[model samples]
Target chain A: MQKRISQREIARLANVRQETVSAVLNPNSRGNTRVSAESRERILRIAAEHNYRPNLQARILRGDSGSNLIGVLINARISQFFYDLLLPLEVELRKRHRRMIIGQLGNDAAEAESVLQNFIDYNLDGVIVLHHDISDGRRLFNHYLPLLPETVFLEVPPGVSGAAAVSIDFANGVREAVAHLAAGGRRRIALCMNDLRFLSMQMRLEGYRRGLEEAGRPFDESLIFIREPRPDYTFAELISDAVDLLAVRGKADAVIAGNDEWALALLREMNRRGLPVPGKVALVGYGNILNICRSTTPELTSIHHGMEELAAKLAAALEKPGTRFPPVLSHLVVRQSSI
Target chain B: MQKRISQREIARLANVRQETVSAVLNPNSRGNTRVSAESRERILRIAAEHNYRPNLQARILRGDSGSNLIGVLINARISQFFYDLLLPLEVELRKRHRRMIIGQLGNDAAEAESVLQNFIDYNLDGVIVLHHDISDGRRLFNHYLPLLPETVFLEVPPGVSGAAAVSIDFANGVREAVAHLAAGGRRRIALCMNDLRFLSMQMRLEGYRRGLEEAGRPFDESLIFIREPRPDYTFAELISDAVDLLAVRGKADAVIAGNDEWALALLREMNRRGLPVPGKVALVGYGNILNICRSTTPELTSIHHGMEELAAKLAAALEKPGTRFPPVLSHLVVRQSSI
Candidate 1:
């Protein structure tokens, strides 16, 4: 067995204080902790040479702990979007010397409650709830909300109270998407959404109406399609039915999907039905998932939801604690699907 | 505010010992602890009626904590496979009252080492390393392997020692795929793989050669295509080049992809080039990602890695520490693309 070198030895060898060694090794050490660059490099080099690795568990147990752990609560079903967001968020968190503990919330209220309980048990510094929804939303808001310690709700439902939030300006994206389609001479544009209960969806509906008004076009009730919230309602089937209702009967010339999955589903169904996209029925998607957008034959036009900016804001909020960050904005990314 | 009822209140009301009440609410409580069904139901119903929720945090802080925390470390990229596996594993873990903390490891060795350190700092009961790859494999084995506490490595690299592992037998899947193609009278079969450095890829290559030998066909080195590990290697371009190489030069009649993504990419490129699928170039993918396989035009033939079985095994291993579970087997799922 080899003898392990401690931070004390490294500090003595480098002619610096033990605190300087600690600050250099610590991930959460801020720039305010002044350590000369030459000393820092020398310490690091010596540590590397000696294969010095800190016993973080012993340090944490001894009460010399750094507040670097943050909990991220995500809805289990819609994890793909959250996962994409997490890739960047994790990198940013790493840069700041912070770590994330992810808790996947199942549809069952009890399970969701248990996850929240576990987060508290873990003694996380703060939490970020990504698309918060439990079976009983009222109970979550009324009882659980008060128990939450330094939390930030992302894409929060309407009328939820007493927490810092970083919400998406979905209406702004929807407006841009609608305006773009309308400018391309798409008069009778239809809207397809997954869930009407989500505040973002409601905002999109409002945006659709406003977009229509701006284009000097009347909003047709029949042109809108909202899928019933059921596990069996496949995205492809819902979009196929929506195409039949809007394109075949309602004579809609353009369509805007609630998200990229809906857009991809619409494209697949249209291709099956021999519908020429952009030539006859233009389509636009939300969430601007670049891979999915580019994968389609006629690359999908989508609303960019600024995931990087949102992640950065969430990280900032987590650090400051109790600070309410402004809502992240969205815009349009035009592609071949919507001309 | 309503008065919060404690477990003691429930126990007193239900005429049972506090230990019995503890056993009832504890997530990790095994079925061997015999409590009468009537007493169990009564305690549960009474607690529900009173809206009693366990204070897990206070319980943990009081040194009466159950070691139910499991840490899952995943490669920063290839998280989709791990995430899919996690969906089922989380459900299974919840049934046993265990919670998971995920640590994402980047390509950088230092970052990976740091994540491992954090996992230790958090005092996790056990750990699962999903597709473990630190830049220096030797350092991972030599230095970090000893530090892993009750860990199970999924799809472990070749020649790794001193850890319980559950590896997918990719060779069996590759052999099955190749034999199926051979039986369909496809003489010249090509194999496309990503990162030959992976033990699984090496196994697949061996399987390809063995499959060819079994079919009494000469092993052609020209039929194999391996891609360099680069971030920007898009699926479409990779498959497009593979198709050109095998179909044009090698004159291959069948192709087996390293994974489902590659298979789908090949299907797309072949479709664009107007090549008749099974009639001209039969294709098979690994990891039968059901949604992607079914989404393609002719559907896709793929290898079923048995994700559910694998997840179940992982959960069982986590429950009984130091027990090495048997390797999960893979088999072929013949879809339309392969005939």
Candidate 2:
């Protein structure tokens, strides 16, 4: 096998200091020092002849100020909502000349730890974690909190120390969704959630109860349905049972779903039972994932959770470290399903 | 700013060789050497005291055997189908203890070049390009073909040189879907596609024509709907126009959509027009995205394009370099929409 060449070899071949070679190669070092044009050309020629490229990883190991790499940690089971958030985030990062490396965290704490470890081992300049569960956040804080000064957590519960967070105001969003339904004379309102253990879902439940009380309607525990969170759990059976309990027995006139997935499943079950949307049982979904909303018959009305704004704010926070951002509010997008 | 400590400094502090320190730090280096338990403990203690972590990326640059990092290149606008593909791919990669970094390529050629450049700069062991357009592929092949020895292109056109590819047999899949629709007493079958420039869509068109000939029906040019690809083209108006052209004018009894997105749009239009699925106009969708298929009212009948199998095959090719893989086939998944 051929021996690989390095910047040291390039400096030896060009008969210049290694720092001179680095100054010629490093884009950030260009303005600081002046290498002779002839020596620079010789270094470049030697580098080209040996097919030598600067190892960014090595530069990072040398404690170079910037690696220009950002690590993004996302949940393993990402939805269209995350993709929507990521697109704009990538655009913003690209504008700053930063490349993103994504790590997927599974439901298991150990797997999430390994993913975070990989990010650290790679020496990423900063990290952005999206939608990590509260328990996972606590575990991560306990073990790796010191490494998170340059990290930002999105949609994490408030009061997490050692890292910045940008949480969605899900409570306000759910209140707006429920109030919209109530204003339309939907007295019997139900809340459908998946895994209330998540901090965001717990906030949604609180918002649901608050909206009902504000609307002068008693909170009905029987109307709230919580199911296990799994990709394979289509919620078909769960939503069917919910329809029986709310629409058939309790005469519920409206329901607020935790996310678009549950809302779509509820819509499917309603269609199966020949129930008229908005006329008989109005429905509202969270995370206004536009494609899923528009694809359904009588386009789903959903809470617009400010995913783009969140991405923009995250980019700003990342670009200017220690820049505090306020919690973004989620608003309602009234489409055909919720009148 | 506080100076960071390296493994060499830790080795110096612990009075051990740098190689011994490496062997202690690297998980892969443990089996080959026998460091005394006391020495190992002292070295580990010193390393911990100095807060030393090995830079895996630098090791890769130094021609170390493995960094266990895979870079996946995805299109900017990824759908649920892509996520379904990625879920299994990530699982398979993780089984081998390899972490994945994803880079998104935009429509602009320059932007795609920058993304591919980032992948090369990162020193990823391998790459997988999913569903990139032909022009982008050509640009990549022109500029970065030599860097793609361990790269695999998924669902890309044939004849791309210098890289392995795992292409979906869209022709066979479309043929199976159309035959199923025709077998159900549908003679005048129409084809709806977006962007004929894509090789996959072109193959779908051929399959549509072949299925019509197989069914002893002439291919009606009026029944084929080809629309330009756009992120915002909801296909509602396009499918509405197709419905008018096929059901109202051409008297087509069935339609084959290019993918699930278009098919769902068609279903929405049919539901709005009070047309019964399969009774009045049967619909078939390609790429059986599970969530979308199950979310619909009648449940979408779609072509199962073997996303899991594709991911498995790609992982196999990546795991064993130079392994040749045959083209995978797509099959019909019968559901209520077509039957």
Candidate 3:
């Protein structure tokens, strides 16, 4: 193991006081006497040769820390989605020596604003909100836009935007799923949905629309079916009614759902009705809920949202501002159903 | 709503500048004489009334933030637990105007140490460790003790020591469950376990032994069995040999599992052999895994570890320095089996 040189050794070698060494180490001299540029460079060179990284904690204790702390707001109700994304993001942020804090917002914009205001009170460098309804989302931007301190928001639906945005690109993710079905010569595809209120739905819909338009396949509205998202909804009559509406009104050679949970439910309903998935209706569920959905008759081909990549981009956005990030693309994880 | 008074206003009112106000707000200031004590007091009083707070970003950018960041090392594997606990702690910390940074140590202690060391290098005010093993437990006091920063460890088993700890008292929790069973007239008891090596299991076992002794019942070692935890084990022969051994040697009237998953497995294993739970063997589980144990032949009587309390304590420990937390006591929620 290599021995680490101390600040004292560097000071002795440079023939400068320890205080001078400290000033150079901080990289930011607020009220302290400005050291000469040449002297600063010589001190740094000597320090580098000795591999003398000034104990950062010692500097912070002396009132200097370059590492910034940022808040990340995520409500508990949507914790399932939030945690899945956060775990990777935490790792990435820590790597760049930036600290991340967690925050939860109430359902309304007022509470969200309160939480945002609280972050401001704490003097956080920036914030990233995981769940923001359109109304609340607009309010968050309007509140923080004045400060504009590297603000970031995730999953804000297209069109309603303020702040540096990063989201799993559902458009490309869903388009690939549809393209896979199209390649397999499937027409009359159905887009199953739980709710169209979420930003994710818009992206899924965009991809679904784009795939059909490019394939020259007529978009069939009759086959589109809406169902309750609850897991227990499998036993409810609404699921059967929705399946019946899809099967009776028209034929759907493939189905794309708003998200993974609904897609799994639709697959379960289809399986119960003796539908042989790909042979009957090829399926692709968005988001990576494959661990639970893989057991279905023909495992649903799904989109991997690339949590690692999204985390990387999110970290980079926080680290090096002005570095453009194109929307993170989700890969089509080809499975049994969409084959 | 009334607008918040800026720190500038307080500074002006107190015959000082905004930076002076900032300096005054820092209660932990060792000896910065940029502002007089009289001006500091006057500014604080006015700021409190007007709800004036420091801007975190400006303070950090200007190299002056009073808020401390606490780093927590959490187990990366338990996604669900991470979501449940970390979310509430975040909210509470914000109320105290502190920030938390999270690091996940996925089964590797060395990696966890490196992550924790980085947090220290960044001059984090405090640190909390969740799910650290016995092997690395000594390092908490050994390597980290010299720094003398506020440190806390959670879920430490019996022997590991040398730092403040916050733990769920599963022993007392299980003792209460056993007492509940004793009250319901279960004299003959069998103990089955899934995670015998876990801290929870060890506490539960101690509870079982103490509960039996309190009830003046003899401890039966022959009836005790440990099995690998899984869902597949539930409906099948996950512990057939243990079941037969307990039945023939122990002749137990009631069975208590180390945790909920193991309890469910035992329940179904017995059910498959045409044995009715509670009729022949009253069964109880721990840690209420939602829905699976319920909707069974005899709904399980499960122990409820207060998630809210746990979350609250976790946050409190991060901010306030306490010798140790009171052991967590849980109530057994009776549905059918014991009741």
When summed lDDT is taken over every stretch of 10 residues in candidate 2 chain A, the lowest stretch is A140-149
Q: Whose DockQ is higher: candidate 2's or candidate 3's?
A: 2
Give the CA lDDT, 0 to 100, for residue A147 in model 2: 57
> TM-score of every model?
0.78, 0.85, 0.68
Q: Summarize candidate 3's per-residue lDDT along A1-339 as a digit string, tens digits.
A: 133467778878888887887778766755476678887898999976654555654444355664466788776565356767788888887677666777677677776666666666554566676766535566556645555356676755444444677767778877887788888988778887766766667677888888888888877778677555466565346656766777545667788876665566667677778876777888787776633344344556788888888888887776565566788887788888787
| Per-model DockQ against the true two-chain complex | 0.18, 0.42, 0.19
Candidate 2 residues B13-54, lDDT tens each?
889888888889877664466688987999999878765767
Stretch of 10 with least lDDT, candidate 1 chain A: A55-64
Q: What is the per-candidate TM-score for chain B?
A: 0.78, 0.81, 0.73
Sum up the clashes in candidate 2: 0
Clashes of each: 0, 0, 3
How well does candidate 1 score on lDDT at residue A334? 93
**Sliding window of 10 residues with minimal summed lDDT for model 1 chain B:** B55-64
Docking quality of model 1: it rates as: incorrect
By DockQ, the candidates rank as 2, 3, 1
Clashing pairs in 1: none
The whole-model C-alpha lDDT of candidate 3 against the native structure comes to 0.68
